[model samples]
Target: MKVLVTGGSGFIATWIRHQLLARGHTVLVMDHQDRRGGLLDGEEFFLGDVRDATAVTEAAAHADGIIHLAAVLGTQETISNPRPSAETNIIGSLNVFEAATQYRIPTVYAGVGNHFMRLQGTGCYTITKSAAEDLARMYNAYRDGGQVAIVRPVNAYGPGQSVAAPYGTSKVRKVMPAFTCRALTGTPIEVYGDGTQVSDCVYVEDVARVFVAALEHTACHGAPAQPIEVGPATSCTVLDIARLVADTAAEMTGRAPVDITHLPMRPGEVPNAVVRADTSTLDVLGADHGADSFVPLADGIRNTVRYYAEHWLPGYQLQAA
Candidate 1:
């Protein structure tokens, strides 16, 4: 199978590319950024944006399947700049769906789990993602042969996860990388709103596996596509993750445990919510489900801490200096 992965340079997309290549499928990565450190030796690369209809269509022409992963994520970033969020998440997604429809290729969309529950705040990220989900559904409805499978992933974290490029905007860091970085540098892990908000943190590799499975699943092609929720069955509080990162970093770096500091909850931040994995979709697809077998949080955090400590910490120190 030849697969084209949009946003293939991203943290999770990189792992998905690797998994696809390992399974003997030719992988083509299409992203706006340069393909400098993202691709493996055998994979092909296409430098383009998902927002461009011509670029996306041309790239989709050469692939058997598409895994659409490109989007402007992060609550603060999307809330601060809703225009680009809508353009990329909603309009860009339409481009992918259009391309898939034109070429009659199956597409796996990367949806967010937050949209499944009641939103706590007025974040445009969720709004745009929900709109994109609807767009995928519309494509699935009218297309004769092209199918679109939506996968709503919970909080995903693991090694190789880092802050996204600035892309002419503020660099917004995800919680795991931010906490691990702070802990490694002896800075306090900042928690918002009493640190009780819960999330299901699935490992990046597991999330990648789900994407690959969805891409290869034959069931999505002939029926109305359903959104597959992917994550661990267990939920962890923000405080739990913070303490775990602190302890793991201290143990690995031989430093003191970093303190967890409380800060005012950011606008649109959920105070207390639980995200659980729904494995029914995975069961139907015959994919390895995260709900039954997810990487233990401690093991995942330990590996992530080691990765930042070894690969990212030196560069960070140099930049700080």
Candidate 2:
């Protein structure tokens, strides 16, 4: 099978590309930016944007399947600039769906877990993603064309994730990287609103596997479009995640445990009391691997801390020098 992955340079998409290759599928990557490196022999790349239907259609001409992963994420960015978010997340998704419908090709839509359970106060990121998910369902139902599977992934974390702004212009503070960096530098790990909000953090490799499973699942074909939840079975509080990173970093760097300091929650950020992926749909699709096979949080944190310590921290030190 030949699979076309949008946003192939992204954190999760990179792993997904490797998984596709491992499965003996021809991989075609379509992205606006070329952050790809170390491509396997015979793999192909298409420089394009998902917002342009013509570009997507041309890029996906030889695809047996499409995995739509391109979108502008992050609550702060979306809230601050809703136009670009809507353009990329909604309009861009529409382009993919249209192309899939045109080519009669199966597509897997990358969705967010927050959109399914809670919508209010989650900001434009959730809003646009929810709209895109709905658009995918609409195309799946009425088009009478190809299959569309929606996978709502939980908070995915791992190595090679973008920890700061590209080119080091500013900070893009994600949970794991932020905590790990602070802990390594002997700085306080900032926790917002008492750190009681729970989130299901799934490893990137696990997520990539689930995506491939969802893309090829037979149960999704010819059925009413429904979302398959993919993530760890358990949920952990924000404070718990912070402390785990702190402990892991301390062990690796021989530094004292960092303090978890409470801070005011950001605007438009909803504190999720509980967040867990419902893998029942995955079970029906025979893709229930993520239910029991997710990496343990502590081990995942250790690996992530090591990645930052080796890859990101050294660069920062050299630049400072």
Candidate 3:
């Protein structure tokens, strides 16, 4: 099988490529050449942005499927930089859908997530992404060709994630990077707002698997997708997550216990922005791949912490060790 992944250098998209390649599938990645990182030495790459329709069209040619992971993420970042987000998430999505239509690809998978409903302060980002999700639905119905699946992933966490500004940056953006960075650095692990807002953190690997599963599901094949929510079955609060990270870090580093501080919640943020996954749709894809098949949450955090310790944070001085 041949596939094209947009924004293939992104944290999760890169993993999507990795998983597809592992399964013996040929993968073509289209992303901005100027972006800091490219795929590991051997991956096929097309240096282009999603908004460049001509470039996207050229890159997507002859591909059996298209995994659309290209978009502007982060609410605060979107508010700070709305133009690029709109250009990428909205206009860029249109280009992908149109390109898929032109190529008549059998399957087009677009990434969506709870951010549509969960993220508030970053209205610029959420609104645009939600609009992109609408485009996926419209393309499925109006375009009248190819299968369009919107995989709505929630709080995906794992290694190889970027920690730079405007990427994982957010006031209420207590997602994967926030939790992992805090745990790794022995920071206070501040839980923004009241610290009671609930969310489910999905392992990035599992999220990639969901994309592949949705792609392979016969029910989803040539059928209209109803925004499938992919993540762990249970949702935990921010405070719960901070506590878990503290405990996990303590175990991993044999460090003294640290306190979790509560800060003012960002405006427009939801208190319990939880999503109920319609497992029936996912079940059609395959057997019960049990919710936590990706990696245990604690184990995932430990691994992420290790990644930071050995790679990104290696040169930093130890905290009075």
Best by lDDT: 1
* Candidate 3 lDDT tens digits, 1-321: 678888887788878887787777787777786543555534677889899999888887857788888887776666666798899999998888888877777554555455556345546777887888778778777885645677777778778776653323333454656665666667777677777776667788888887866665523366434766676756677777788877776776678656788777564456656544544445545664546455767777777767766765554434224
lDDT (10s digit) by residue, model 1, range 219-271:
34442357888877677888999999999999988889999999998876766
Report the candidate with higher lDDT, 2 versus 3.
2
Model 2, which residues run further than 4 Å from truth?
36-38, 165-171, 218-225
Name the 10 consecutive residues with the lowest summed lDDT in model 1. Answer: 162-171
- Residue 137, model 1: lDDT of 83
Instruction: Give the root-mean-square deviation of each candidate in angstroms.
Output: 2.6, 2.1, 3.3
Model 1 TM-score, all chains together: 0.92
On a 0 to 100 scale, what is the lDDT of residue 294 in model 1?
Answer: 68
lDDT of 2 by residue, 176-280 (tens): 777777888788988888888887788889889888877777234543356888777677888889989988888988878988899888876666557677867
**Order of quality (TM-score):** 2, 1, 3
- In model 2, residue pairs whose N, Cα or C atoms come closer than 3 Å (at least 3 residues apart or on different chains), thus clashing, are none
Candidate number with the higher lDDT (1 or 2)? 1
Candidate number of the best TM-score:
2
